[model samples]
Target: MRLRVQGLPTAAGVTRVLSLLAVVAAVGLLPWLSGRDPALTVLRARSAEQEPTKEALDAVRSDLGLDAGPLDLLGSWAADLLHGDLGTSWVSGTDVLPSVVSGLQVSLALMGAAFALALLLAAALVAPVLVRGRRSAGAFAAMLAAVPEFLLATVALLVCGVWLGWLPTSGWQGPAYMVLPALALGVPAGGLLGRLVADALPAVLDERWVELWRGAGVSRARISAAALKRVLPQLVPQFGMAAVGLTGGAVAVETVFAVPGIGRTALGAAKSQDLPLLQGAVLALLLLGLVMGAVAAFTRRRLLGPALRDASLALPAARPVRTHPAIPLTLLTVLAVAIGWGLLRDPYTVNTAARLAAPSFSHPLGTDGLGRDVIARLGHGAAPTVGTAAAVCALSLLVALILGFLPGVAAGAADIANALPPVIVGILVAAAAGPGTGGAALAVALISWPPLAAHAAALVQEVRASAFLTAQRAIGASPSWILTRHVLPSVAAPVARHALLRLPGIALALASLGFLGLGAQPPAPEWGLLLDESRAYVERAPWAALAPAVALALLAGLAVSGAAYAQGRRVPRTGGAGSTGSTGKKKEALVEV
Candidate 1:
């Protein structure tokens, strides 16, 4: 047997190193760019009563080495990072390394548990779809995947902790405390991974090898194993994405459960404007994400094995095909009705007498603790929440298309951006621009384009490889003509479909940040802001929380359904709507015929 080892290309290694440097540079430069006097903020954090006179602020800045220019400070910090020094916390006046290490330990444990749970859930969901060809199960998983981790964390806390009294509500006391947070992070991630697997499997099963295995009387178990092996490599990118999701989702999960993980630590540091601690936290999370991506890449290489040498092999890929319309159509109807009804109510008129009022003729969804109508807030919030999400999606699609057409430009930057989650980006944005809707939108847009870009890039490569494209090239057709007439039509529809599916996720990310006071401010009636406002009064008035929560749930359902319906409705001229080139739908169609 010939043994061969595959490693990341030299270019990729250089790209990664550059990406790391870029992140470190950004972290180092943040305090200087933020405009807020870091010295004053540190003084207040250390001693709130201390008068921030010029002398005091100057002393603190000199002591922290912030008296230098931004580039000089960044260089010094980078030098310290090379020598294993993480600097000192501005808040606690202690070494940042120790705090970061302790928090990293807790966050790593939570992330590991959550990722394991996600895999288990993915396996369970995929097993049924693979064995029984259950499309309904896949559809259900898609909807479940759209749910935000914060919402899951909140519901799990209420049902499993407060209501049933089964698990501890908060704190990092022991394993018991980990369950709720893990469930919150894992379920949605699992659903996403499973959806990808389910969509890819039908095509794999239809491969001639499966028939050959059956004809040779190979055991069902062996055949299934072989099929999974073929499908698994296609999931490497998604696995990395799932890893990012687990870490990013931890911010809200940790906050909701009061887990002393890095996410919460980072959040606290951001709020206090503790540049040292926040820098350490961001670095740690960024490194962890890249490491996970590397691990996934390594696993994919190992899985490919002989396939690496077999140039003629045609590996199966996932495709977006037709799906049943019932679920999506039903979800669309529900959202429309809810939004229309809530539009008629007043969201701003407050009445102290009706505070925490239950559902009645006057207020269908009841009133918040501040006596603002729940349904009205939810209805009014839809425009800002959904409109901003749509804008983010549109911007991401634009970026994806540009990057997709150009092969290598900004690829390293995309890697760096992918390492930072929307929430983490939000922390950075808030540090510089202060918290607001515009900053939140920019933060989300920064990290949201990588996946779509990957999709578009893959599509571009696929189309470029096709015989028709080659034939056109052989003829007198110009590159621009071939691209515009052939490539754009083929690439645009599928990428757009993928971007459409992301609307709910972008909205959720925005809401999660808003829930953490990093997005829309008060009186705006944004869905996430409303949820944040109501969380404190959840026990006193469940309706206030439930109204927005239910509304978010409905929104998730709508996105999933709408994406499915659109994908089902459109017929691609070349490859499938899915970024993956799997012919699962074609396989199913053959079976039906």
Candidate 2:
């Protein structure tokens, strides 16, 4: 939470910037690494069957800088970059600079609308703090955060466009068409911000400063303002991270709404595997996120000013975990049954007779372009998608437990792992594993564990230092017994909760890779890969795309619900004010486990 001098690069910040730069550089080389002749792919994209003559190939290699050394290519691109040339599109044979410029405007506009709506929604959540609805607000946010923006766009389309006939479903019409999409994007974004706000606020209000204000006969309104002022700086990072991820999330959102923003451009580039366009778009998004983050951080600090200072007084400790409904468990149960059923059937069998049919009695989810059952593929995909997610969460929980006992190494490794965005991790994993569902699963599972591991490790370390654990050690309890019986059982819920919370992230990573044709290849029927296959025939068969998206969102909801359920459990509170801790002295009772 420490803010260095304005524009100073902390070791972590520098590592992040370098990581992104490396990703962009590595991304540029992907077309060459694909094992396809870069020249042939470029030529074929432009012509139906351009004869792959040696002379023609050689000319292409020269024109596209394919034959140049990496440093030479970098120098060439750098020179071009100075002159405002982002190179030409491999497929379209047009300058990329103009496209990037125009696309940035569109993305900014779309993002602005989304942010405005998100801010309003966030403001409304603050009301619950004054009232007595903290638990209810948390539940609401958990529900919203569980659902992805794509599904939200789908629901908006169904209601505003189809059901009410009040808005257009698929276009970049004027602001009218923009409203639903903005809402679709913003609500979930805001839900997360609300959760962060709520989580941070109780601790702020519990600060000894607030008690001092009360003792000094300060007005309640002033004390509340003071609490919010202090909490606002903590929010800066979350807000920026959310915005950066939202830019990436926009790929799905824009695709669903048919908005002509950078997302759709990136989606097209991904599907076409157009190297220059994809690289340009990826670089743009990455740079956009990094730059926007820096700007947002500066702005937050400048605005907060003195409020950014750390308090000498101990803040309110964490709140007591509350109880909630079992909706998540019930929902996950239903989803598990569906996936289990899918595991029993093969979705790849071609049924040409029902080719391209709409949803009907026999084909519950309808048929795809090749007459394969969509439901079958979706069902079959469940074992990989959901099952992979489950495996990841379980693995993360296990790793965190083992590593939690070794804080120094765990914290440093987690910090490094968490610094790299999931997209970078996914792409690297995909490249290493090659193209298959199993590879995709492994890539996702590997990338998805870090943040959860970091959080879990921090919490676990706190648990390990408690009085109960010390007492257990003195009671002739072996380390093995303490970890297996005492530690694992106690920390399991929190770890489970973190894992469940990561489902949307897993879903997003899967879809991004799937869109790039790097996910489960033909007949595997993964939702993301389904979306990829269906994009071409969207006009002919919209349901093909819609079904998988809805299913993915539904599953995400179930996962979040499961997390909420885990969070709501009445667990034994093991540590509080009496415990000597990591951060500082604990004046207030804040339960650790």
Q: What is the lDDT of every predicted structure here?
A: 0.82, 0.66
Per-residue C-alpha lDDT of model 1 across residues 1-593, encoded as one tens digit per residue = 85435874454456757877766788889889786999888888789899999999999889878898888899898899999999988878899999999999999999999889988998998888667766666776787798999988888877788778899988998899899999999999999888877777877888898899999999888888888888888677678878987888999899988999999999889888888899999989888888887888788778888658344344453445566788777777877787888898888999999999999988988999878888888888899899999999999999999888765655776777777888898988888888899999999998888778877776777777766777788888898898888888767776786787788889989999998889999989998888888878776787788777888898888777777666667553434322223342232212100
TM-scores, each model vs. reference: 0.90, 0.79
RMSD of each: 4.4, 5.5
- Model 1 TM-score (2 dp): 0.90
Kindly report which residue stretches of model 2 are placed more than 4 angstroms away from their true locations once superposed.
1-14, 45-49, 132-134, 203-223, 303-317, 320-325, 344-346, 352-375, 390-450, 456-497, 500-504, 515-518, 531-550, 573-593
lDDT of 2 by residue, 1-593 (tens): 85569887555456545655666567656665554566887778788678989998899889888788767776676677667667788788887777777777777898899988888887788667744536466556656765667657766776677668887877776888788888888998888887667766776776677788889999877777777777777567668877876776676677777787776676566556565666676667767776776776686767566654443333354554454456656666766665665556668788787778998877766788998877778778776666666666677667766765665555444433433444444544444345666666666665455555555555666667777788888879899887777666655655565565665567657665665566667766777788778766765676877777777766766665655455455344434433324331221122211
Q: List the residue pairs that clash in candidate 2.
A: 206-316, 207-316
lDDT for model 2:
0.66
Clash count of each predicted structure: 1, 2
Error of 2 at 131 (Å): 3.9
RMSD of 1: 4.4
What global local distance difference test value does model 1 have?
A: 0.82
